[model samples]
Target: MTTVFRKALGALPRLGVQVLDLGPGAAVVSRRGGYTATKMSGDSWMVGGKRPRTRTTADGWGLHKAAAGDLCARHVADLLANYEVNCVFDVGANKGQYGRQLRELGYRGRIVSFEPVPDALARLRKSAERDPEWRVYPFALGRSESFEDMHLGWKTMNSLLQPSAYGQRRYKRFTDTRKEQVRIRRLDEVMDEALEGIAEPRPYLKMDTQGFDMEVFAGAGRRTADFVGMQSEVAVLQLYEGSPRMNEAIAAYEDAGFAITGMYPVTREKTTGRVVEFDCVMARAAAAPSRQG
Candidate 1:
């Protein structure tokens, strides 16, 4: 149903129709050819043409290209609100872009960002200096505590893992142009220390650590239960050496009591229309009922 609606909505602009929002879940569509479509209800529409006696439900009519981003942003904002998330762990935060986006989307909660790269950390600190609620850390999270060589890419594509040959071939920008030694620590070991003294810490975790998401999750260990929701970047293709594939990432989250709620494509190959990576939003899975005595 969503696919059908998306296809129909995608064809609207080409047909000279402009979609105008009337209110929540309703819209007024005007065509350049002097026709107007006013949504009366989810299941009813009024056409400006000859008063046709038949009326049909306009269920999925208002979705448009320009509104997709807004829809996603609102969806995430609602999730944060629903869970009453007080703190967001912005893992693999490079230049605090994810944190900034969350703030732009109206999330007023506290944000703790972790970035290990020297230059990137500097920029992240600068960007977050004005926001007292947004804190920046100078370390990376992984399966264990140690120092590791980070592969630096053209811009924000740096990762602890080496890029696969296919990754370099598909996107030259992901090529490991240089290396930086960064401090890495296990999230479980430092979770309490990092989030110390929070009165009500309902943490929402968001990770964009290139292809090292699974390791981060593993490092979270029992601390995963403390989070109400999490979002991580998962690969559809093998972009980095030893990176978990989409299914593997999903299974890991499931094992940690999380259920996949949403997925948004982050990168795609233009030629093949294949998704390279996507961000998966997960929430704590509901527990099954106990057996009757």
Candidate 2:
């Protein structure tokens, strides 16, 4: 491999783009090659870099490899051909960075957000206060439709519904917590009440509630729209020992008609032995066999 090829891998790691394979095809799942990624199968993909000879532009400017396009789709054809997504239902929307990014990119549609931690809720609310299109939900969305006393993980910014599952995580970053009761909602129910009146269409959904994506999906019930696209900040199997089951998650999403098309990292290990991690699964609703034609 050339120095540029090596640099592409090393450079994008900083921005959290870890899902790249350098040949032999289908074996990318086991292509750890020292990096961390969710093992995948089936045809739910929009990009490929399996050929060892195709490693040069793995992080180039077009798709089909690893270059950074407008939204990081590894394949140019997918980026340019896929249906355009406008509305966003952002579950577990921490500081509203996702929302901000959408706005920065000139996304002109509704952004319904959900967050559990009070600190994050406040910050997210303030960050989006000026945007009329942003509707922030100061609560967590799960299978339950009631309030619960969720333990604010030590890193309040990285809080989760099940605290003990995190064992003990202590980051030196500035994080604080105030444990008061927080509301939980079944996403479908909340949408029925809060957004039912809107004459416009439904929105695309993004979930990053720790390992709580499946729970949120269940609460969504049959409320899923046909044209909806979904993105999630999913947890990789290797991180957080004893974390939620990955197969169950993939199956749950598949059941909901979402095909996992792409995965991107968002955090890199600052040290040698720690490891780089995080995958945001980009998915789209798949039609039934009968509807595909």
Q: TM-score for each prediction?
A: 0.74, 0.61
TM-score of 2: 0.61
State the lDDT of candidate 2 residue by residue for 46-67, as single tens digits.
Answer: 4443435454432322242222
- How many clashes would you count in candidate 1? 1
Q: List the residue pairs that clash in candidate 2.
A: 16-265, 23-50, 58-66, 60-67, 63-74, 63-76, 64-74, 64-75
Compose the digit string of candidate 1's lDDT tens values, residues 1-293.
45655566667878879765344455556674344555433344445543335643221222221133344455667788777778899998999877888898679888989999988999999989999788888999988898999888658888898888888898778743788788998888877766777887888888889888888888888899898889888899988889989998998888888888787666666556576777788877442112311
Model 1 regions more than 4 Å off: 1-71, 286-293
List candidate 2 segments past 4 Å from native. Answer: 1-82, 153-157, 162-178, 193-202, 225-227, 238-243, 268-277, 285-293
lDDT of 1 at 131: 96
Residue 140's lDDT in candidate 2: 91
